[model samples]
Target: MKPAHRSRRRGAPAALRWPAIATLLAAAFATSPPAAPPAAAAANPASFAANCGTKPVTLQGYFETGFPGTVELTKLFTKQYPNVTWKIREDPFAVITQDAPLVLSSPNPPDLMRTPQITGLVKDHILLNLDRFYKIFGWDKFPASDLEQLRVDPSGRPQGVGPVWAMGINYSMTGVFYNKALAAKVGIKLPPATLAQLDEDMAKAKAAGVLPVEQFDSAGNGGLIFPLQYLMADYTIAASGSVQPINAWVLDQPHATIVTHANLLAVEHLDQWIKDGYFNADANAVPYSTMMARFEHGQGLFIFDGDWESGNLDHNFPGKYGFFLFPPLKAGGKQAAMSAPLTYGIPATAKHASCAAYFLNWVQTNPAARALNVAVYGSNPGGPASLPIPPVKPGTVTAQTLAAGRVIAKEDGAMGFIANAAGPIDAEAWTPAVQKLFGGQITPQAVLTTVQADYEQELSAP
Candidate 1:
């Protein structure tokens, strides 16, 4: 990104006003001011050190439900750094992902916020570089992958485009989960990497009176739509020879790069799945829980799910089921991928940066923290292999899974970064476009045509 573009990303004016506002709030309500007893009294803004401890810092923390360790971290951060109180801000993960940039771009930027910030944030220059904070973060103490995951650019190269805002608070992967017993009943193996084979198995399962797969649609957007992204990634990787058809968009932002054959093929596969009854006829409309509920009741023999399902299943009986990464759709294809929700970094102006450091440092050193983090949030920070403490029921995602993902990252010469998570490419176009394609309302060629046309028509115009 250019220097001028970088400047525009400066949280605008709303970001600049936050410190003053936080300071006033802290001072005025130090004692938790009484609720509107009479006329409103003006409050003074609070002040704090941008670095840590020494100067009073008011850290604005953003987190999602089930994001383990944050609430505790806020408390610990305050204790560790006097005068540093974290204004804990929690929201639905999706809302946070979609609007964090807008919120951050506002005048009073978050001093310290959390979200699964995407690579685009780094490309756009909205994050603080933690290169210097390495010493503070005590990077040497943790596994290398975990340390690198925290960096915006682990390679320290600009071309790679790294994470600008968050560290992995929790990690989860999307894949196919199946009932082992049912697989046996259906006379098939588990997690068929090839969808053609899975289709055959599904036919058998359906004949056995089971919904071969439980895939929700838009109403359950969080899981299905998101899990589908991995299929999209695989398609892009196999067809385009690159992700998002980078083309010249790296240098020119006005015009988006074009789509590849595999991109359309992936969408087509999804559409076909819908048509074949392998997925919901209108999966977009059903809630994820309904699908899971069906699967748990043994109404469904197969379920396309991920690690997060484990937590919900464990707490609630989702029947006896086993899981694995969603195998590749193509025959003789590669194994499943590490499609994650992603994590983020902190900004330079973060009020509780130093405090975050203390907690982050603790993240590296403590096993108990890791265990609690996993059980509470269903995340595998670096990888199951790199975990300081072994998570209970570390099923398919063993250290080996983490190792393979790392190897893929190393060999592919780049870790995957989701385009939507980055900046606004256009949710309206993206979701609707994919949904239309998935529903067989369009073809692969048509999907690509739509993306290209949409990009040129909407993003390129003055």
Candidate 2:
């Protein structure tokens, strides 16, 4: 979620404007075809032993504030390679999105920075093309789907083909995190298997004076988008048997639209949830942190969030929470969730690209680093599918989220965040539209039409 600080750097280039960036991207793709993936032998594990070299070096990084997993991983990296230290800068997710193009264009950019949307940055020739690193590190060995989200075609669309631009320290998944004690109070013997059962449970919680769901809908962040997208995925799958339409829309495929019948049904469901008071009364005012705090304090029965918080919940409130994918529409039906990497990339002008690439590869393959990813971030350390997941303690929230991630993988139900449909789609479109829905100012159909209109305008900007 973007914070209130949405300022851009002074005197930034006009070319950096998102619409202009899109135009430039289309031009680039038309004239110069994207390079094919490099061919190389599998990277040997022993090769990483000295990938960073013996000389003293310091890596510059820009990371999202409040997530300690990346910083903690950097410290671990330095521990193994004492000569390599880090000088890091931090910002909230929204700030990073606004600043990414400017920073990547700077003469002195961070060696490694958190990447937001790639379509613009890729087309502007600001982000380093990691096709070479892919071969050098034998990243091809990882599951194809694991890397697909990071791939972009010549047309700047994410078709899971073409050169790889970034790599994930760990892949994150999203779902429902419920307070276990509250579940027993509501007589929910097990997590709901169907949406109807979930609705029934939330009604029970409300009857018992419990907040049925604690989600944030604050302007800019619009945390409600989580459940809305989850519902869209469920409805899409129920109708079409796959999430490709939603994924294609998010990947910016030509002629893609979110105004389908399934999506309309999804929005109507969320509108009903709003009308039924399933969400917090002050949801529109709550931010991500406040919502998490409220849930942790037992102020609500459930929260929709990503696996990134699993470790924090396990550590702070041990044995108090349980997680499940948003229930499917029918018993034993397929499930889906928003899952993507905490992507990081090097600037085209970065000074230590090689060492930075080494660090990225190590984060996934090194036993200690992979363990830190699981233990600290509670995410899958994405590497070769053959590399077993680090053992998680039973009964921990991290364990449940990890298990849920496997369910998503097996079902092929992963969908990118809908907010990422375009550069400003989250803040300028979905956030405002959904907030209006919560305020009873807009109908369910209006929510879809409004966002789709905004999406078209942004993508077609001159």
Candidate 3:
């Protein structure tokens, strides 16, 4: 399940205020092509010499859930800098989101933590500014878009453009996972190329006496939000003529709101999917884990989830499932997907702050670390420069997932995950509003208006 968005109540005035709606719209629909990806650069491990002074160091750290890459990266770091030791702990995402501020404020905060709830953490001055580190490591070599995910204004709100406050260890995207065996059973020879074709395939799956999609709604909005946001991202592009506006809105840019026509179309499409019997009848009753279990057990033809599940799916199903981007609404439309960084930041009061910075710097340049991120963790290492494209092994779901990430990167097709916008806008508003729609208690239009109301309230807060 996605973690709930968190907002900070105590902060100086926002460093980046909301942009005017007109400005946001113009930028979103701007026709200019994105800049070219930069050439790869060699990392200077020599620059880290000053930080690795002749002192014995034990670095304490925490991470959301259990990302094995953290352990692998830590081990790799210590091996290279043998003077340093690591004491790492793990916690569930919800717990981390709620407790990070308190933990960071303590006199003995972990030296480093996987902090995805950056809006609140940045605003509250819990994270150390990495400006000097960024300069030393030449981390600005990363794609501007990749770096933007880590930037926040001085007031701590996510500005999508400003000082770098954090960096992502892995890149993740939202996409469609299908049961290859079931696809064959339903006579689907190739993945659908358009939304209409996807709907047709879903109809076939339903007719073949299988659940068309495995989704969960019991604990929260993962079931609804994931696929719906995928559609919302695509629809935003189709409506506004580019994905920039949607990214702006999702990054909490000034004047961005959820009550847009694209979002309305996304919700309407979801309602139509439900009415067409594309989802499980027990969708409202099942949790996301159960849904994945059901999908892995071959109870559904397809599942909507993130790349984080790729490792699990590969282990359990092997060649059984295939991963693909969600087909566009129309032929040749943008192949938009929800994406964000598996980001981490250092606490200002961290005891071994330099060691933490060295580790972050090492992640992007070390081929072994990047491979572990992909092969073991099933994540795209959002490093400064691209790694050699791994050879695709046929029938490997992870290979396909990495391929999808490459496409997103090459095409500049990632839009922010909707829930990353704000707490009130997503967890407090969209989640329940979607549940209401799923339960037949409200309409798609109601979902739009309700979320917009909460978004406005959040922006207007003191």
Q: Rate the local accuracy (lDDT) of all candidates.
A: 0.54, 0.87, 0.78
Scored by Cα lDDT, where does model 2 land? 0.87
Instruction: Report lDDT (Cα) of residue 43, candidate 3.
Output: 24
Model 1 TM: 0.68
lDDT of 1 by residue, 399-427 (tens): 32333444344434222333332234335
Residue 417 in candidate 3, Cα distance off native in Å: 0.9
TM-score for each predicted model, relative to the true structure: 0.68, 0.88, 0.86
| lDDT per residue as tens, model 2, 1-462 | 244344343445676677787998898888956552232222333343337788898999999998898999999999999999999999988799889988888767898999978877776677777887777788989988888878887456544678898999999999999999999888876589899999899889999988999989898779888999989988999999989999988877778899999999999999999999999989999988899889989889989899999999999899999999999998999999999988998887777778898999999999999999999999999998889999999989999999999999999989888988766799899999999999999988999999889988877864
**Residue 338 lDDT in candidate 2:** 93
Question: What is the TM-score of candidate 3?
Answer: 0.86
Q: Which residues of candidate 3, in runs, are more than 4 Å off?
A: 1-51, 389-394
Highest lDDT model number? 2
Q: Give the number of the best model, judged by TM-score.
A: 2
- Total clashing pairs in model 2: 0
Q: How far off is residue 216 in model 2, in Å?
A: 0.5
